[model samples]
Target: MQVSYIVALLALLAVTATAQPFLPGTGFLPLGNLRTTDNGGPYNISLLTVQANEIKGGLAAKQNFTDKDIVHFLTNVECLEGLFDTWGTFGHGFNNNLTLGGPTPIGARKANLSDAVRPFMEEVALNEQGHALFTRQAGSDLPCPPIDFTGGFNKYFGAAYNLTGNDTIESKFGAPFDPFLNDECYLLSVLSLEELGATGNKGLTALLTNPVIANGVAGLATSATAQATVQRMLLWERRNNTVYPFNETVQQVFARISALRDSLDGPQMDDQGLVNTDPRTIAVPDYYVNMIPTDVRGLTFSRTPQQLINILTLGSPDGVGVFFPKGLYGAINKPTGFNVSASGLDSFPSSGAKVASQLSTQQIGTLPGPMLPPNVTGELDLTQSLTGTLDNGTAATRGYTIIPPGMPYFSNASQVAVAYPLQTGSSNASSNGSYAYGGRRFF
Candidate 1:
């Protein structure tokens, strides 16, 4: 079927054969000798399509799963992919620059962007049998990992939101944003892939629809470059630029919405061509493949890193601050939705995370200067930036204040660095990728 399992296989670093055939064992993991048992469980996937349609009589399996067979079955169940990649970042609000978010240098462009490409572009814009398995494999390369699945974004300034100093883009979310990166959701995913390549529509009505491939996703989503590949694929395509390059029918509606969103290998469906959902009847993970590496260098990538520290350190080498001094932009907060509040996980760098806990968690450990001193965010620094104006005028001096626009979380963690947003047993800053801790050990 898979060409007698790829003509009895031979490459892919060669496991030789027995890539199938292991049997007996489920919860503890094993039943694999290539069928006749263990679909991992939950009605063992209708005896795996009734034993692959009694070994191909009724058909279906000329080719099925791939992201290279879930990265070779999670590298043959050895583990260590950790859902998303770049191995979790760490560059908090202040005290940064040791290389900031690591893993580039060898020639940049690999800055991270695989939170499953925005829930596989919101299940190809909300499902319909995931748009017919996103039109039966629309393009290919497959495997849509996003790895984990946190979602929660767009707090305004875009990506992770930032206002640095002289901040512009029409002062964010109000309009303007074309210093490049194009906005409006990258121009509504590039005019919706330029209207699906001037009207091919992936063969009609997009992604084939099955609620967009059972929400794991596999179609639509295309920007297919013409210009700005975010500064030319982050300097020459190291790949992973917030994962857009999509195509093979939007990577099979994001591998069929990561195969109905369920992983750790129960109903696994990544590598695009998904059908998942069985991590004990699904808790979540059919469409989140954000690996985030859209080409990085000295920092300033956006998609949220405190909006690149509010547009390059409060609008820096010198755009000026004290509330945009002339860049002017204010009022939108709507409880964090106008975006750019430092980079979102609530502004990072705060190890303990517990300060009675709540000013909407920008965490706030050392800010004062990156621009927040207009009455310390006393709710109205429309950003004209004389330094946003301070003394106690506050554009963000750090004692933790800003809670006015629509206030919701983070009044604590001690204004930015005190305890537990997952510092858990306590320890942090092993360099970037979120709280890595000095000695670092989240493997």
Candidate 2:
């Protein structure tokens, strides 16, 4: 009887080992025998089975724009390409000099860059190259227009500082304000381009019709914002450091450059510097670390294509200016006298005080820029430096304590990880190219 029972148990185990689970539509075969072909196999879900009417319907779903709208979009793309290409050229020149010993001397003058700063410069140059390539791929067919990096800086810097002659830097400060001359100058030049790229792409986002194209532009804007933020942080760290031959602190130079941009980009206060005396709007104390420049709602500022051209052309009525001697390669290269009215719109309150009264105290703050120190004419002291140690014995960190305006601050990675736990269970294909759950299959 015992021998007969053992034989029956052995037969039951063999049957169980060879058995396969039943699927809803597919008959049972091997344990994991679900397979699919290029034509979607047993499921019969082939693109060839789709009707011509379906294809037409899919194509018709796309939004169509007028010729004028197309031209506007294309022109914005071209402007972005131009900006990226120019910055890439600047970065490439600086990086190439590094290969030949170090940053090449501009005439007899030279600037020193630390190991920490050099890597960031190299990365920014490469990033600009990527940005230009992507912009060209997106529809910017125009070649880079004539750029005046050398004479352009001399001309624009002179206008900004109220200096006379083309050799403004040489006459007023003994050395030219050449970006390639030093790390500070290079960073400042890059900052200007980056800010424009960010604002330009952001302004165009709402006008884009295609989701894929709009997403691409939004990505470019985000990257430009990140690049600008890093550059600003680096400059703010060296706010007290002096620019060569100018006898002005880095912060002072930033203020002047920002002022130049604001002056040329119409009456709108769209530009800002490293520091400001504005009272803190958010819950933090009256700390003045102007790293991320934003509007009252903590939103990034946007610039119309025309306003961007104004700054690029140094407010040239004929369009041609310092950066692009022959003007930008697009229809929107010239400013159209489209200035935002200083008064609030008819639909909104005219007085800023009225607007402030409506909003909570946590949301009130002045505009960025005009970062001149209160009543100080000489170089800014260490007290103004973002990275400088405070007299109260607290260490100044890189980014703000409260980021993105209202979100609670996460002090470290552990806090973030705890707040947003990692999800378990991944979707992966089996060894036989079938899904783990065995419903879908791939060739």
Tens-digit per-residue lDDT, 262-342, candidate 1 = 111112111111111111111112222122211111111111111111221122323223212222111110112112112
Candidate 1: stretches off by over 4 Å: 1-17, 20-176, 179-443
- What TM-score does candidate 2 reach? 0.55
The TM-score measured for candidate 1 stands at: 0.17
Global CA lDDT computed for model 2: 0.48
Which candidate has the highest TM-score of all? 2
lDDT (Cα atoms) of all candidates against the true structure: 0.21, 0.48
**C-alpha TM-score for every candidate:** 0.17, 0.55
lDDT of the structure predicted as candidate 1:
0.21
Per-residue lDDT of candidate 2, residues 190-286 (tens digit): 7866788888677656546677778877887898899899999999888877777677777777777777776665433456667643221111223
